[model samples]
Target: MTTEQLTIFAILAITLGLFVWGRWRYDIVALLSLLAVGLFGLIPPQEMFAGLGHPAVITVAAVLVVSRGLLNAGLVDTLARHLTRVGEQPWIQVATLTSIVALSSGFINNVGALALFMPVAIWMSRKGGSSPSLLLMPLAFGSLLGGMLTMIGTPPNIIIATYRQESGGTPFGMFDFLPVGAAVTLAGLLFLSLIGWRLTPKRKEEQDTSKDLFEISAYLTELRVPKECKFAGRTLHDLMAAVKDDADMSVVGLVRSGKRKALPSIFEVLQEEDILLVESDSDSLKTLLDVTSLVLAAGEDQDQDQDEEKKKKKAGEWNLTEAIITHKSILVGKTTSALSVRERYGLNVLAVARQGHRLRERLGKLRLEAGDVLLVQGQEESLQSTLNELGCLPLASRGLRIGKPHKVLLSGGIFTVALALIALELLSATTALVGAALAMVMTGLVAKDEVYDSVDMPVIILLAAMLPVGQALETTGASDLIAQALLEIARSASPAIVLALLMTAVMLLSNLINNAAAAVIAAPIAIKMAQGMEASADPFLMTVAIGASCAFLTPIGHQSNALVMVPGGYRFGDYWRLGLPLSVLVLVVGVPMILWFWPL
Candidate 1:
C-alpha cells in the first residue's frame, strides 16, 4: 500500500476502535477523524468540509425534522389508540407492533419510526405483563429490517443509489430495492415475532416490579393557583377532565391557608392562592402550568417580584432537571413545604422519587431523604447551581411534549406529499423533504424554535464527518485493493457464492461502524469486484444494500438499537442473542432473493 493508503487505514483503525470503546460520543469521534484526515492532507482542505452540505446529510436532517413534526402532531397517540384495540396477547402484540414499525420505517426514517413506536411497545409490555426487552428488541430490529424496503428508508440505501448514479449507470428507482428488501424483511420479521423474541433476557420482568414501572410518575409536585389564574374558578373535577386525555397528571389534594386537605372533594372549586397538589411526570409539568396558569408555590409566601420575573420569561426558556439528593443535602430530612424549596433555592421541585417506592402522602408534605431523585425546574443556569448547593447529582431527562392532535392530518399530509414527490420523480429526496419540513413550520405543525431541536445534530455531524473519510478511502485506491482481494477469493467460487460472501463481509463491517459509512466504502468495492469478474453489478450492489442495513449484532451498529437500549434496560451483550440469528437469516435469505431478482 502507498503511504497515503497506509495513513488512511491507520486513521480508520483508530476511529473504529474509538467507536467500539463507547467512551466518547460517536459524533465527536467522527469530527476528530475528519480533522485528522484534513491535517494529514489525505483530503484537500478546500473539500474537507464539503460533506456537511452533501445531499445525503441534508436529506437526513430534513427527514429528522419532518419526523419530529409528525410526532408533535400526535401521530403516535393515534396509533396507540388503534393499538389498544388489537388483541392483548404478548405474541399478538409483538406481531402487531413490529409490523407497524417495520412498515412505517420502509417510508420514513427508521430511527424516527422506532422512536414513535417505542412507548407503545413499552405500554403493551406493561399491559400484557411481559418484559419490555422482549418487545423492544423486536421493534428495533424490525425498524432495521424495514429500512431495506425503500431508497429513503435508511441512509445506506440513499448512499448506494448515489454511488450507482455516479458510476454512469441509471440510479436505482425507489421500488428497485423492494423485491430483495421485501424478502429479507419478511424473513427477519418472522424470526423476530416468533423465535427471536423468545431468546431475549427476562431480567427486567423478573427483577423489576410494577412499582418500578411507575418511577417516572414520582416527579409530581404542587403549584398554587394565583389570583389571576384561569383555573381558580373551575372545579377540581372540571380541571382534571380538561387535561385527562393529554396531560399525565392528577389532582391529589388541596392546601388552603397553609392547612392541607388530603382528599379534597371533586366538586370543590379551586380558590385564589389555593395550593392544588398535582401528580405528574416531568414532561407534562410545563403543559400543566401553562394550561392552569398556576404559579409554582415556594411556600406560604407569595413573592410577587419572583412571580412577575418568571412570567416574563418565555415558557420554552425554562429547563427541567432531574437530580439525586446526596447524603450531605441540607433538605434531606425536610419536606418540600417546610424547606420552602422555591423560596430558598429559586427552583421548583416538579417531582420527587425515593428508590422505587411511591410517595402516597401529599407532594409538599412528603419528607425528602438522601438518595431521593428530584425533578427540579427553573432557568438552566439556576437549576444547575441549585443542584450543586443542594448536594444533588443530575440524572438524564425523561418526558414527552404534549402536542396538538388536530394538526395530525396536516402534518401527515405534508409528509405524504413529499413522499409522492420522490416516488413520482417530481423532486429530489433532499429537496422534497426540505420542502415538507418548511411546510410543517409554515403551517405551525412544528414551532420555529423546535426545528433546530428536531434535527439530530450528532447524527448529522456523524454522517457529514464520515463522508469525507469515505471519499478518502476511494481516492487512496484502498477500496479497489480490497475489492481485488475479494475477487481473488471468489474466483474459485460460483457467482452466487461470491455475491453471498461479499454481502457477509459488508454486513460484518456495518456492525462495527456506521451503516452509511459501510455502504459508502463497500459500494465501490462491490462495483469493482463485479467489473473484475465480468458479472452483473446489480446483484453486487444489492448485496451491499442488504448487508449495510442488517446491523443487528450490536447496539452501536444502528441508531434504532441505541434508542431502545436505556428504555428496554438492555446490556451490551443482550443484542447478539436475538440479533445473531436474525442476521444469519438475512444472509441465508437475502442472497438468493438478490440473485433471483437481479441475475449475475
Candidate 2:
C-alpha cells in the first residue's frame, strides 16, 4: 500500500475501534477522524467541510423534519388506533404492529416510525398478556426492513443515490428501490409475525412488575394537603412516622405556591394546601392518603378547575408525555433540580426510567442521562418546545387526539406531492423534501421552532463527517484494493455467491458502525467489485443498499434497535437470537430479489 493508503487505513482502524469500544460518542469520533484526515493531507482543506453541504446530508435532515411533521400530525397514530382492533391473538397483534411500523418507516425516518409505534406495542402486549419482548424486537426489525422501500426511507439509500449521481449517472429515482426492498420487507415481515416472534425469549416474569413499562401510573404524583387533614402542622419527619412502616412511600419534594424544595429538611413543617410530591406505589399511595387525609393535586375536580383556569389564562394547556434523552441532549449530566425543570419551563417531572429500572432518586435530584425515559407533565405547546430544546424525542402516546383525520390527510398530501415531484424529476430529492418540510411548517402540522429540532444532529454529523473519509478510501485506492481481494476470493465462485458474500460483508460492517457510514465506505467498493467482474454496477449497488439497512444482532447497530432495548427489557444477547435468522433470511431472499429486479 502507498503511504496515503496506509494513513487512511490506520485512521479508519482506530476510528472503527473507538466506535466498537463506544467509550466516546460516535459523532465525536467521526469528527475527530475527519480532522485527522485533513491534517494528514489526504482530503484537501477546501473540500474538508464539503460533506456538510452535500445533497445527501440535506436530504437526510429534510426527511427527518418531515418525519416529525407526520408524527406531530398524528398520521401514524390514527393508523395504529385502527390496528389495535385487529384481534388479541399474539400472532395477529405482532403482524399488525410490525406491518404498520414497516409501512410508516418507508415514508419517514425509521427510528421515528419505530418510536411512534412502540407505545402502541407495549399497550397491546399488556392487553394480550404477553411479554413486550416479543412485540418490540419485531417492531424494531420491521422499521429497519421498511427503510429499504423508498429512496428517502433511510440514510443509506440516500447515500447510495448520491454516490450514483457522483459517478455521472442519474441518482436512483423514488421507486427504484421499491421492487427489491418490497420483496425483502414482505419476506422479513412474514417471518417475524409468524415464527420469528416465537424465537424471542419470554422475559415477562423476569421484568419488575412494580413499575409499569410505560411508567404511566407509577410516576411521582403530587398531593395537596386539605384543610381537613389531621397532620396539618406536623413536621415532615412526624408525618412520615405515621405511615413510614405501613407504606412504601417517600417524600420526594415539597412544592408550595409553585416553588419546589427538593429533599426538604426533616423538620420542615407542612401547612394545609401544600403540594407534596410523593413517590410510592398505588396501594402505598392510597394508604398514605388515608393516613394523612391528603388529596391528589390532579384529582377530577382540580383538573376541571385547572381546565377552566387554562381557558381564562389561555396558557396552561398541559399534557403528560414521555421523552427519551438523546446523546446530543443538553440535559445530560444536569439534575432536574439544577435545571429548575418545573420553575423554568412550567413543567413537572413525574418520573424517570433508565435501562428498564425506575429510579428511586428524588425527581429533582435525579441527573438525566442519554436514553433515560422521562415522564413529564407540561403545557402542550411549551412541552414540545422544551423536549426539543433539551434534545429529547417525545414518545407517541397511546391515546388518539380528536380531529386527527384532517391533520393526517394534510400531512400525507404534502409528503405525497413531494414524492411525486421527485418521481417526475421536477426537483432533486433534497429540494423536494425541503419544500415538503416547509409546507408542513406553513400548514402548522409541525411547529416553526421544531423544524430544526426534528433533525437528529448526531446522525447528520455522523454522515457528513464520514463522507470525506469514504472519499479518502477511494482516492487512495484502498477501496479498489479491498475489492480486488474480494474478487480473488470469489474468482471461481458463481456471481450469485459473490453477491451474497459482498452483502454479508456490508451487513456486518453496518452492525458495527453507523449504517450511513457503512454505505459510504462500502458503495465504492461494491462498484469497484462490479467493474472488476465486468458486470453491471446496479446489482452490486443494490446489494450495498440492502446490506446497509440490515443492522441486526446488536442494539448499537441501529437507533431503532437501541430505542427498543430498554422498553423491551432486552439484554445485549437477546437481539442475535431473532436477528441472526432474520439476517440470514434477508441474504437468502435479497440476492434473488436484487438479481431479478436489476440483473447482473
Candidate 3:
C-alpha cells in the first residue's frame, strides 16, 4: 500500500475504534479524526471544511428543520392519534403501528417520526394487554424501512446520490428509491407484524393499572407508618434516610385521618397510623420495610371535594405523566433538584428509569441523560408547556395538539410543493428543502428563533466532518484497495454473490458506526465492486444505501434504535434476536428487487 493509503487506513481504524468505544460523542470523534487528516497534510487545506457546504450536508440540515416544522404544526401527532384505532389484537396493533411509522418516516426524519409514534406504540402495548417490547422494536425497525422510500428520508440516501453524481451519473431523483424501497418495506412490515414481534423479549408483564404508559408496578407501593415505628416523630425527609442512600423513590401522596395530600411535603412529620403512599425504585423494598418498621397497607381512594364548583375550579389539580428525555432536552446532564423542578414548575420527579430498569440513585442527585424516562407529577394545566420547554416527549397519547387548520394547511402545503419541485426536476433536493424550511418560518409554521434549535447539530457535524474523510479514502485509493481484496476472494463468483457480500459487510459495520458514516465510507468501494463486475453501478450503489439503513442489530447503530431501547426495555443482546432475521430477510428480498429495478 502507498503512504497516503496507509495514513487513511490508520485514521479509519482509529475512528472506528473510538466510535465503538463510545468514550466521546460521535461528532467530537469525527472532528478530531478530520483534524488528524489535516495535520498529516492528506488533503488540501481548502477542502477540509468543504464538506460543511456540500449539498448532502445542506439537505440533511434542511430536512431536520422541515421535520421540526411538521412537529410544531402537529401534523404527525394528529395522524398518529387517529392511527391507533386499527384494532386491538397484538399482530394488528404491531402491524398498524409499524406501517404508520414507516409511512411517516418517508416524509420526515426517522428520529422525528419515531419520536411522535413511539408514545402511540407504548400506549398500544398498554391497551392491548401486552409488553411494550413487542411493539417498540418493530416501530424502530419500521422507521428504517420507511426511510428507504424517499431519498430525503435518510442521510445515507442523499449522500449516496451525491456520490452517484460525482461518478458522472444522473443523480437519483426524489422517488427513485420508491420502487425497490416500497417492495422491501412491504415485505419487512409483513414479517415484523406476523413473525418478528414474537422474537422480541416480553420484558415486563402488564401492570394492573392498565392506563399507565410505562409498567412500574414494582416501582410503586403503599406503606403505613405505625405508632411503634421508631421514625414516627421524624420528618418524611428524615424517613427518606432510612431508605437506601443511593436509591431513588418518592412519597407521592399521604393520608391523614381520611384526608389525602396529593403531594405531601418532604418536611411533613410522620405520625401514628399515617398512611404513606411511597414509591421505591430500588430492589430495597423489603429492606426499607424492615429498617423503618413500616407495614404494607392497601391504598384508599383519594376522591377530593364534592362541590361541583370547587371541582371545576381545580379541574387539573394533580396528574401523572411519563416523559422520555429527547436529545434536545434542556434537562439533559442536570439534576432535577438543580433545576428546582418543584420550585420552578410545580412538578415532582417521582422516579426515573434508564436502560429498562429504575435508577437507584437519589432523584435529587441523579443526573439526567437522553432516553431516560421520567414519571413526572404535576398540574395538568401547565404540564404540556413545561414538558415542551424541557424538551421532554410526554408518553401520554393526548399530548399532541392539533394546530389551527390554516397552520396545518400551510405546513403540509409548503412541504408538498417542495417535494413536487424535486420530483419534477424543477429544483435540487437541497434547494427545494432549504426553501421549504425558510417558508415554514415565514408562514409561522415554525418559530424563527427555534429554527436553529430544531436542527440536529451533532448529526450535522458528524456527517460534514466525515464527508472529506470519505473523499480522502477514495482519493487515496484506500476504498479500492479494500474492495479489490474482497473481489479476489470472490473472483470466480457471480456479481449477485458479490452484491450480497458487500451489503452484509456494510450492514455489520453500520451496527458499529453511524449509518451515514458507513454509507460515506462504503460508497466508493461499491462503485469499484460494480466496475470489477463490468455491471451497472446503480445496483451496487443502491445496495450500499439500503445496507447503511439496516442498522437493526445494535442500539448504537441508529438514533431510532437508541431512542426506543429504554422505553421498550431491551437489553444489548436483545437486538440481534429480531435484527438478525430482519436483516437476512432484507438481503433475500432486496437483492432480487435491486437487480430487477437497476439492471446489474
Candidate 4:
C-alpha cells in the first residue's frame, strides 16, 4: 500500500514481463531495472552498484573460468571415450549418456558440461540408429540435475549460498548441497533413462537413412568463373540480384587463383578464374550457371567433399564442420557482418540449421543464438581455438579433439586444491576459486588472452544487477508484504506444504526467467515467509536453491535446455512432455530431502 512498495512492484512486474517476452537479453533487462530502482531512490545511491563486487558474482565468473580450464584439459574427452560401445537399447543408451553428463556437471558448469557431451550423445544416437530426440532431452535435464550437487555447479546455488552470508550467516560450504542435490539428481536421472525418454516425441530414427538433419550438404557447389563469362567483371551483388529470387543460395566464399576469400563482400568485383562457393541445389546451380555462364570447377567435388569432409578434417587445414553456438557465445546477439567472424576467427558461416530445418539464405546477416547449428568452414586448428574462445562445440561426428595432457595435470591439481580448501573451510569459495582461475592461466591450462573470455559476462551482469533489486525488496519491506500474502494463502497449512508452495512458485518463476534472477528475487521472500511461520530460514533458503534449479519446463528457463533444442529437434512444446513429470518428481523428492536435512 506504500509508495515504495508500489514502485518496486511496478518495476519488478515490468522486469518479469520483459524476461518472459524475451525481446531483449536478460542481462540488459536487469541493468535497466537496476537503473529504474536507482532513479526511484529505492536503494542507497552509493550502494546501487555494490552488487558488482558481490561474492556471488565473483564466484560465478571464477567458476566459468575454472570450467573452461577443465574443458580445455579434456576431462570430458577422457570420460567420453568409447561411449558408443556402452549399449544398444534406448534405456541403456539414455542411462549411459545422462549419467556421464550429470557426473561431469557436478564438478564444472552444467552448461559447459552439457556442451561437451552433446556431440558424444549425437554420435551415439546416429551410430546406434536411435532417435536423437530420445537422448538429448534426457541429457539436457541431467545437466540441470547434476548442477544441484555442488555450489559451483549452477549459479542459483551460489546466489543462495552468498545470500546466506549476506543475511548474517556463514556462506554454505562447497559440499553443503550434496545430500539434497544428489538425491534429486538420482531420482531424476532414473526417471529420464527409464520412463521419461518414452514420453519424448520421436523426430526420426537413425536407421532412417532416407532422412537427414539438414539437406544443405547437396546444395553447396563450387563454380569457376571463365574470362568470357558475362558476370566476370560484375560484383556478386549484381549476380545475386539476378539469381537470388529464383534460388535460395548465397555466395558463402570465393577462392582466388591461390588465395581464398571467406565471406567476401557483396560489392567485391568478380574476376576470371575466381572460384565461387555457391550454396544451391542442382536446379538452382543450373539456373545460376545458365544465367552467369559460370562453369563447374574441375576440383569441385560436392558429394565426395561433403561426405568425406569429416574424414579429411584436420586442425591445421581448411575444412567444413558443424558447430553449435552456446548461450554464452559472444556471437549470440550479433550478426556475422558485425563481428567480422571470417576475419577475426578465420571462418565462414556457410549455413545455419534451427530445430532440424536449414536456413542458408542470409547467413551473412543472420543473428545467431544458442543451440543454432552452423555449417562453418575453416582450418580445424583455427576453428578449435576460435570455437573455444567463442563458446561453440563442434559436432562429434566431425572428429574434433580436446584436452592437453600437461595442462590437464597442472589444471587438475589447481582445481583439486581449490575444492579441498572449500571442503576444509580453510578459504572462502570466492577466494579459492579466484586463485585457482589465475593458476589456470599462469600454468597455461587456459590462455592469457582467453582469461576474461571464458567468463560468461552476461550471466555475471545478470547476477550483479539483480542482487540490489533483491536487496531493495527486503530493505523496503516489500518482501515481507509478499510473504504475508503467501502466508495467508497457506493459512492453516503445515510448514511442509508452505515449503512446497514456495518451491512451486520459484519453479514457475524460473521457467519464465533466468534461474539466477529467480533465486535473487525469491531469496528475500523465502526468508520473510520462514520468519512469518516462526520457523528456521535455512529450509526455506534451501528450498529456493532447489526450486530455482528445476527449470525443466521450458527451453527459455535454462541455457542447458536451450543448448539441446536444435540438436534434439525439439519445438517449444516438446520440453513439457518429460520436464513436467520430472519437475513433479523433483518436488516430490526434493521437498522431503530438504526437510530431512534442514528442518523448518
Candidate 5:
C-alpha cells in the first residue's frame, strides 16, 4: 500500500477504535484527526477547517436547534398529553405511544419525540402493571423507524443526500425516501407492537414493590409557605389545583402549627408558616417554590407571621429532592461544576448512579454518561425544562413541556415553512433550515441560550471530521478498491441477494459504529458496487440509507436507543432481544420493499 493509504488507514483505525472504546469524547477525537490530517498535508491548510463550515454539518446543527424550538413551543407536548392515557392495556398503550412517536419523528428529531413520550410510557406501564421494558424498547424502535420517512427525520438520510450532492447528483427529495421508509416503518411498527414487545424481558412487573422498576428513589419532603406564596391565603383545594396547573406540584397533606395533618380537606385555609407535606420530587417542588415563593421548612418552626414574612423574599428555601443521572444522557461528559447545569438550566445534581459501580471521587466532579441515572433536586419547571433541553429522558411518570399551548400553530407553521421550502427545492436545505432556526429564536419560541444548548457538539465534530476522511477515500480511489472487493464477492449472487447482503452489512456496521459514520463509510462503496454491476445506483444507495438506519441491535447504534437506556433502566444486552429480531424483520420487509420501489 502507498504511504498515504497506510497513514490514512491508521488514522481511520484509531478514529474507529476510540469511537467504539467510548473513553475519549467523539468531538475531541474528530478534532484531533482533523489536526493530524492537516499536519501531514493530507488536506490543504485552507481546507482543514472547511469541514466545520460544511453545509451538511451546519444543517444538522440548525435542524437540532429548530427541533428544540418546536419542542419548547409545546408542539409535541400538546399531542402527547392528549394521546398518552392511563389504565389502558399494554398493547393499546404501546400502539398509541409507538404510532405517535413514529409520526412525530418524521418531522422533529426522533430522539426528541421519544423523550417526550418516555415519561408517559412509564406512567402507562405502572398503571397497567406491565413491564416498562416491553413498552419502552418498542417506543424507541418506533421513533427510529418513523424518522426514516422524511429527509429531516434522521441524520443518516440527510448525510446520504449530501453525499449524493457531492458526487454530482441531485439530493434525494423529502419524500423520495418515503416509499421505502414508510414500508419498513409500517411493517416494523406492526411486528414490534404485535410480537417484538412481547419478547422483551419482563423486569418491570417482576420487580419488588419497594424498588422502582427504573430503580430511582422516591423521597418525602415538606414545603413551607412564605407570606408571599399564592397559596398562603387560598384554601387547600384551590392551592392543590393551582399547584397542579402551574407549578407541577401535588399536595400530599397539610402541616399546621407543627403538627402534620394527613389528607387535609381541600377547603382548609393555607396560612403563612403552615408546612405542606408535598409528594412531588425535589425538582418539581423547587419550581413550585420559585413560582409561588414557598420554602422548605427545615426546622420544627411554629414561628408564625413575623418569621414567614421575613423569609418570603428568600428564593433558596425550595426543597431539594435527589435524582440519579442515567448513563444515557448528553450530560455524561459534563459535571455540575463544569457544565454549570444548576446556573445554566436551574437543576442541581444531588447524586450519581454508580449502579453498584465504585465511585472514584466526589459526585460533583464526576462526568456523567448513559445508564448513569442522576439523583437531582431542583425547581419543578426549571428541572423539567432542563431535562427536556439536555435530551435526558426522565424516569418519572409525569409529562412536562415549556410553551404556551395555544401557540402550537405558530411553532408548527414555522417548522412547516422551513420544511416546505427545502422539500419543494425553493431554497437550499441548509438555508431553509437555518432560516427556520432563526425564526424560532426571533419569535421567542426557543430561548436564545437554548439554540446552542440543544445541539450535540460531538456529533457535529464527528460529521465534520469524517467528511474530509470520506472525501480523502473517494479522492484516493480507496472506495473503488473496497467496492471492487464487494462486487467480486457478490458476483455469483443474484441482484436481490446482493442488495440484501449490502443492507445486512450496513446494518451490522451501524450497530457497531456511529450511524452517520457507518453511512459515510458505506455509501461510496455502495455507489461503486452499483456502478460495477451496471445496476441502478439509487436502489443500492437507498439500501444503505435504510440499512444504516436499522440500528436496532444496540444502544450505541442509534441516538434514540441511548436516549432511553437509563430512563427505561436497560442493560446493554437488553436491546438485542427486541432489536435483533426487529432488525431481521426490517431486512425481510425492507429488502422486498426496496426491490419493489427502487428495484435493483
Candidate 6:
C-alpha cells in the first residue's frame, strides 16, 4: 500500500474502533480523524473545515430542520392515530405500522418519522394485548425502508446524490431513488410483517413486562407525618432507615406546606405535613403507612397545589420525564446541577437513570454520559427547548405539531413542485430542496426557529468531517484499490453472484464502519466494477445504496438499532437472530429488484 493509503486506513481504523467502543462521541471521533489527516499532511490545513460547506452536509442539516418542522406540525401523528386501527391480528398490526412508517419516511426524516409513530405502535400493541417487542423491530425496519424513497429521507441518499453531482456535475432528482427504493421497501415490509417478526426470540417477549424501562415504578408513592412524629424534627437521613425498611418506597423529594423543595440535603429538617417522595407498590405502601404513626393523604397526588401554582406562574410548568442521551451528544460530561441547568435554562434535574439502575440521592451531582437516561422535571417549554439544546433525546414519544394540518395540501403542493422542478432538470437537487425548505418557512408551515432546530449538529459535524476524508480516499486511489481486490475475488463468478457478493461486502463494511463511509468507499468501486463488466453503472450504484442501508445484523451497525437496544430491553446477542435473516432477506429481494428496475 502507498504511504497515503496506509495513513488513510490507519485513520479510518482508529476512528471506527473508537466509534464502536463508544467511549468517545462520534462527532468528536470524526473531528479528531480530520485533525489526524491534517497532521499527516494528507489534506491541506486551509481545507480543514471545507466539509462544513459541502453540499451533502448542508442538505442533511436542512432536511433535519424540515423534518422537525413537519413533526412539530403534527402531520405524522394525525396519520399515526388512524394507522393503528388496522386490525387486531399481530401480523396485520405490524404490517400496517410498518407500511405507514415506510411511507412517512419517504417525505421526511426517517428517524423523526419513526419517532412520531413509535408511540402509536406501542399503544397499538398494548391494545392488541401483545408485547412491544413484536412491533418495534418492524417499526425501525419500516423507517429504514421509507428513508430510502426520497432524497432527504436519509443521510446516505443525500450523500449519494451529492456524490453523483460531484462526479457527473448533475445530481439525481428527488424521486430518482423511488423506483428501486419503493420496490425494496414494499418487499421488505411484507417479509418483516409476515415472516421476519416471527423469528424474534422469546426472551424479547419477556422484556415487555416493564413498559417504562427506566424503572420509574420504584420512585412514586404515598408518605405521611403524624402529630407526634419525632421524625418531623429530625433530618432527612433520620428517615433513611424507614425508607430502606420499606422495599417498595424510595424518597424522590420533599413537599412542605404545599410547596416543593429543591434538592434538599440529608440534614434538612422535616416538619409536620412534609410529604416524602416515596416509591412503592400498593401493598408495601399500605404496610409502611400502617407501621408509621402517620396517616396517608386521601389523594395520592405527589405535587402540591402551591407547587403547581408556582409552575403556572412560570412560562411553562415543570414536569418530569425520562430521556437517553445520544452517542453523538455534546452534553455528556457535565451534570445538570454543575451546569446550573435549572438556573440558566429553567430545568431541574429530578432524577438520573443510568443503564436501568436508578440513582436516588445526589441526582444532580451525578455526571451525565451517553446512553445515560435522565428523569428531569422543569418548565415545559424551557425544559423541552433545553433538552434539544443539550442533545438529550426523550425516551417517550412526543406529539408532533405542524403549524396547521389544514395546510397539508399546501405543504404537500410546495414540496411536489420542487420535486417536479428537479425531475425536469430545471434546478439542481440541492437548489430544489432548499427552495422547498424556504417555501415551508414562508407559508408558516414551519417557523423560523423550526428551520434550524431540526438539524442535528453532531450529525452535521460528522458528515462535514468525513467528506474530505472520503475525497482523500478517492483521490489517493485507495477506493480503486479496494474495488480492484473485490473484482479479482469475484472474477470467476456470474454477474448475479458478483452483485450479491458486492452487496454482501458493502453490507459487511457498513456493519464494521459508518454506513455513509461504507457507501463512499463502495459506490465508486461499484461504478468501476460495472465498467469492467461492460454493463450499466445504474444497477451497481443502486446495489451499493441498498446494501449500505441494510445494516441490521448488529446493534452497532445502525443508530436505529442502538436506539432500540435499551428501550426494547434487548441483549447484544438478540439482534442477530432477527437482523441476520432480515439482512439475508434484503439481499435475496434487493438483487432482483435492482436488476429489474435499472436493467443492467
Per-residue CA lDDT of model 6 for 312-419, tens digit only, reads 435233345666676656657777646756446655454566644555545445677777766666545565677777777665522222123556567667777877
Count of backbone clashes, every candidate in sequence: 1, 0, 1, 2, 29, 11
Which stretches of candidate 2 lie above 4 Å from their native place?
A: 208-323, 375-405
TM-score of each: 0.72, 0.84, 0.85, 0.87, 0.78, 0.80
Cα lDDT tens digits for candidate 4, 1-600: 899999999999999999999989999999999999999999999999999999999999999999988888876677777676787788998999898888889889998888787777777776677777888889999999999999998999999998777767898889899999999999999999889999987877422412345556567678888988888888887887787556556676677766666557777899998888777767778888888788987763544443343343443356566788876678887887689775577676767887677775566567887778887766655667777777777875344344433456677789999999999999999999999999888878888887787888889999999999999999889999999999999999877788899999999999999999999999999989888988878889999999999999899999888878877888899999899999999999999999999987
For residues 1-600, write the lDDT of model 3, one tens digit per residue: 999999999999999999999989899999998999888888889999999999999999999999989888888777776765787788888888899899989989998899888777777777676788888899999999999999998999999999899877988999999998999899999999999999998866522224454455556666788777888888987887666464456676777887767667777888988877666755667778877888877434322322321343255566677888987788899998789776577677877878756665678888999989898876667777788878898775323333333367778989999999999999999999999999998888878878987888998999999999988888888988988998998899877788889999999999999999999989999998878777788999999999999999999999899888878878899999999999999999998899889997
Clashing pairs in 2: none
Candidate 1 lDDT over residue span 349-443, tens digit each: 65665543334445666788765667666554466557766766554333322223667788888988988888798888878989999998898
In candidate 5, what are the lDDT values of residues 1-600, reduced to their tens digit? 577767766787887788788777667777777777777767778887778888778888988998888888788888777754434677777788898899999888887888778767766675666666768889999998998898778888888888777656788887889999998999988888778878776764435312343232243456788876777788875665555444434454466765555445556888998887655556667767766677877654524422452243143333233233444355767875677664466564544554323243444457776566665555544555567566555665222232346568998999888878877899988899999999989999888878787787778888888778776666667778888887788889888888889999999988878888888888888888878988778888888899988888888887778766655557789899898888888888888888898876
lDDT of 5: 0.73
Q: What is the lDDT for 277 in model 6?
A: 61
Worst 10 residues of 5 by lDDT: 208-217
lDDT comparison, 1 vs 4, better candidate:
4
User: For residue 255, what is the lDDT in candidate 6?
Assistant: 71
> How do the candidates rank by TM-score, highest first?
4, 3, 2, 6, 5, 1
lDDT score, candidate 1: 0.75
Q: At residue 206, what lDDT does model 5 achieve? A: 38
Expressed as tens digits, the lDDT of each residue in 301-381 for candidate 2 is: 445544444343344344566677876777889987688655466556667888766676655556788788887766565
Query: lDDT for every model?
Result: 0.75, 0.83, 0.84, 0.84, 0.73, 0.71
Off by over 4 Å in 1: 204-206, 209-254, 258-404
Mind sharing the TM-score for model 6? Answer: 0.80
Q: How far in Å is the alpha carbon of 99 misplaced in model 6?
A: 1.1
Task: Please report, as a residue range, the 10-residue window in candidate 3 with the lowest summed lDDT.
Answer: 301-310
